[model samples]
Target: MSNTASLKKEYAERIVPALKSQFHYSSSMQVPVLKKIVINQGMGIAVADKKLIEIAINEITAITGQKAVATISRKDISNFKLRKKMPIGVMVTLRHEKMYEFLERLVRVALPRIRDFKGIESRFDGRGSYTLGIQEQIIFPEINIDSIT
Candidate 1:
């Protein structure tokens, strides 16, 4: 949904060299690289309105240019009346070019669109993985703003 530019180019052209020197890496190959990007959304409202999942899947597919799949519940929950295999969420895992392309749009466009956004907090899981939560999908320009209610 962005220009033809890619995050991979920026990483190789600028970030890689900077990190290579900052960490004193003997070779560029030693630098750690991203393998994939996982975008997920939990739709609790789906419990009452099954059509919401289909709409979400359409929006996510439009944004990521990939098919989104529903995530099913593993077990039943009595209080919420949740049943096993109920579609409770949606997720899409992007790899290679799509991952980098999404990252490019996320960094260059979506994040900046947040109102009053100063910066992002950096938190990496113990395994060198990171996670970030964005409350609204409207930040993405690819989604049709009018379609969301």
Candidate 2:
């Protein structure tokens, strides 16, 4: 894919050199690169209908092209009717090629489709990692609108 090829070229020709110059690093390996893309969805309704977790898992899989694993509660909360080991969310971690592909789709396709869209915030964590939250999965072209419920 052109996106994949261009991203690779950008990293090699642009990013690696920029990092090396900025950080005064001697080896190309010292430059940081995107390691993974994590897609997560919290299934609060799973407490009422366990099947909801499966739907979230399927949605995440469609968006990321990877199967999602359930995230269980780490502790019990009596008032909230939560228990340890209860599946409360689904997450997929995309590495290597999949991570780059998903990013290309997100930046080139999905983000532009939103109404009244401004550019994304340029905020990052101290560690240089960024997180983006999408309001709906239908914004992704891979998902068929008619199939959404």
TM-score of 1: 0.93
lDDT of 2 at 126: 100
| Candidate 1 segments exceeding 4 Å error | 1-6
Clashes of 1: 0
**Per-model TM-score on C-alpha atoms:** 0.93, 0.87
Top candidate when judged by TM-score against the true structure: 1
Instruction: Please identify model 2 stretches exceeding 4 Å from their true place.
Output: 18-27
**lDDT for 149 (candidate 1):** 77
lDDT per residue (tens digit) for residues 1-149 in model 2: 57888888888999899989999999999887888888889887798889888888888888898889999999999877999999999998999888888998998899999888998998999998898888888889878889776
Q: Residues 53-146, candidate 1, lDDT per residue (tens digit)?
A: 9998998998898999999999999788899999999999999878877887888899999999988988888998888999999999998789
lDDT by candidate, in order shown: 0.89, 0.88
Poorest 10 consecutive residues by lDDT, candidate 2:
1-10
